[model samples]
Target: MYTDQLKRKLIIKKPIQRIVSLVPSQTELLIDLGLEEKVVGITKFCIHPYYLKQNKKIVGGTKNIKINVIKKLNPDIILCNKEENTEEIVAECEKIAPVHVSDIYTLDDCLELIHQYGNLFNCRTEADKITQKINFKLNDFKTFIHNMPKKKVAYFIWRNPWMVAGNNNFINHLLTLNNFDNIYNSKSRYPEIELKKIRLEGDPDFVLLSSEPYPFKEEHAFEIGRFTHHAKTIFVDGEMFSWYGSRLLKAFDYFKKLHNRII
Candidate 1:
């Protein structure tokens, strides 16, 4: 008997050889944990390790899964995330195989997810190595950021309707870790707001445009800069801030560079 982050029970076979990963971060983590060969299915968004799309079965996307494709893969287990995937997806996956859903917010939650994957995939050593590297970088980042002045930021994830990273999410958690106070922290999840209203809240110190989710380009920075002329509009790597897994091993270093750039 195996338990998932959602406390769901699953009967997994020993020497687990087949896997279906719904989350991009976890897909990358699975590969880093030395389960590359075991991954039989991956979402179209699972672009990490670049060549993954070439070898693995494409299972549609995080929200819209191709059930027929997953069935063909015949994976031993399926992995999903609370934020990236939906309840409907979980229910659908349950019909085919056991589903493990992970809900991550803080760094602790990320560590727990890695530890859980370690236990589930029988890759405790590789998992531990990844976690240790992340922790080491985390500690180093803490020291690096200790002397830096905290800046209030508006971290934008999307445009058009214009959604910004809000409270209780991984991006906001990472912002907090980087000592960047999120101006929209009071809002729930990803909140859509009017551009004109940004000035009313008192222009933030920075307007960070994320690379993913919306693919905010240099032009978007200039557009956002027009709204909050006082704020410095900068483009940030969404993966470094948003990805929770072995990716954290590289995130701390990115944070240091980001902080220095801002300073």
Candidate 2:
């Protein structure tokens, strides 16, 4: 019988209408995928695109999410990352809504994540166009940097702890793509090394201090500058190097500007 008491619950198969992104990279990706109206909440760390600051509600950071605030947002989908977000936060968010986690380390991982997001958002066409554009730009950058002499570069992610990006990181891949050889390839992922060791044998051609994780300032550069005589130390945007999403579309031009300034 079609009585309300005998009716079964229906499942909705529509695309997610409201999304809350825990990771900054995924937030930027969602925005790039034309999901601005769909995204209702974002982490405080999701500062890229600049306008997110004005429009999006802060649900907390990647490591620490405001679960109560998130519940209030009533997001249908919550996007996060394995490296950037903690398991507890993911589990808590799962209680509120379905959560999709992305793990990205290399260029291939980035492309795969893009494809997955495309499928998830029902925006496969736009995703394919973006992927093609990114691939073309990356290929062009590779060709341009291929002939140039490889420079030894040390990318710093933290200051007091003295942590630097290692071979398994996206920044390392980007550096290799840009014809810059990472001095910390021996170590895996972000490793803590002594400044004395860096002074003794690191001998990097360039020292890139990231703006996040430690917020390296110009004065800090002057401090590290003493150790590296041949290396030119500059404060670089952490997002440009680490974000593996649509932010990458804008990274090539930034890289070109950086290359021109350095070379």
Candidate 3:
């Protein structure tokens, strides 16, 4: 038994057979970890491995998990995240099985989680392959990044009320890796701000709109452009920027393409 991100010791004396993953990113990881048969439940948002939803029982969305459905599932282990799941849900899940919570803030944290998942699921070789791939890509991206100039950027995850990814988060970490300096680095986490006030003064060089949580479209970027003429708006894959799982294996290529787009 060892401590998870929440410092809760998870007792998995026997092999983990049935698992309920509460996070989409982690759900994708379970697939990468070769635990497809073991994963009996996942959220509706666990759309990666696309057939997963059709085959597995979806407990609910990330923010709102169906507790009764989870209890009925009688999972031996529940995979969750500190940011994606609530404490109350964790408690309820613990009642059914050992809930291992992950707190991911950086690329290292993501790799570490993958490592831990390997230990948890008895898939060490596969997990090592995944992390190795991620590390190789990270280093390759770093080499490319070393030659690039730092670009000021504003990454938006939501619309309507207008919220942007700030400091000390996974999205910001990717932004940093790309040498895309976050203009909102002064702020922590996602912050609601007035898009109408986007002036030329200290404004971002680019306004990146994510395709998840809010699903910002090409039209949305154009709409935001009217308010901020200083920044060139672009629609980016939400998964590449936010997903801290096996999806990261493809992020560096996307990042390289994105980096080439900027002057």
Candidate 4:
């Protein structure tokens, strides 16, 4: 018997052979941990490897999942995340197999998740290697950004409702590590903001438009720049700011380049 990050008790059998990964980042981590063969099912958004969807069964999406398909997969364990998946989905998956839910809000939390995966899947060696690389890159980034001045910014995640990354989330955690002060740090999680409010209260130095969830193009940047006339609007890779897994190995370098470009 074992407990997940959410403190849910699970009876997981060793030598776990089958897996159903509902989160994209976790799916990628599983691959990095050399559990690719064990991953029987993955969501449509798990596109990191670019070839996973072609081989693995597609399980609807992060918000919506095909329960029937998961039931048929007959996975030994179902992997999920606190933010990427909902409580209802976790409850449903529990009926099919032991569910391991990870709740990550910081870099430390992400490292811990990797360690947990190591113990769970008997891949401690692979997990350690990944974490070591992340730490190496992370420390280098820290040294590179140590002297850089902190910049205030508003990170927009959506447009139709005008949502932005707020406090107490992985995005915000990474933003802080990059020395970017989120204008909405006072608010919890992702929050919707009015353009008027952005212009009035959040006088940010930059308006970062994410390249996922909404695909903010150059025209969108220009449109947002018009509203936040004082701030520079730039399209940033959502994966770098949000994806908290093996991708972080590349994300630190991306952040360094982004800072240099913006500077």
Using Cα atoms with residue i matched to residue i, what is each candidate's TM-score against the true structure? 0.97, 0.91, 0.96, 0.97
Q: Is candidate 2 or candidate 3 better by lDDT?
A: 3
Compared with the true structure, what per-residue lDDT tens digits does model 4 show for residues 45-163?
Answer: 99979999999999899989999999999999999999899999999999999999999999998999999899889999999999999999999999999999999999999988889
What's the residue-level lDDT of 46 in candidate 2? 84
Q: How many Å off is the CA of 252 in candidate 2?
A: 1.6
Q: For all the candidates, what are their Cα RMSDs to the real structure?
A: 1.0, 6.4, 1.3, 1.0
lDDT of 3 by residue, 13-63 (tens): 778899999999999888888889999999999999889999999999888
Shift in Å, residue 92, candidate 3 = 1.1
For candidate 2, what is the TM-score?
A: 0.91
Candidate number with the higher TM-score (2 or 4):
4
Clashes (backbone N, CA, C under 3 Å), per candidate, total: 0, 0, 0, 0
Q: Tens digit of lDDT per residue, candidate 2, span 1-263?
A: 11111122222255589999998988888888888999999988888788787898998888988899999998887887778888798789879877777777777788887887787778998889889989988888877676788888899998787899998878898888788888998899999988767756568989999887788888888877788867899788887899897878888888888888888
lDDT of all the models against the reference? 0.91, 0.82, 0.88, 0.91
Question: Which lDDT tens digits does candidate 1 get at residues 1-263?
Answer: 87877787888766678999999999999999999999999999999999999998999999999998998888788999999999999999989888899999999999999999999988899889988898989999999999888898999999899999999999999999899989899999999988888877757999999998899888888888888858998889999989999889888988888888878
Candidate 1 lDDT at 42 equals 97
Which runs of model 4 end up more than 4 angstroms from their true locations?
Answer: none
Candidate 2 positional error at 72, Å: 2.0
C-alpha RMSD between model 1 and the true structure: 1.0
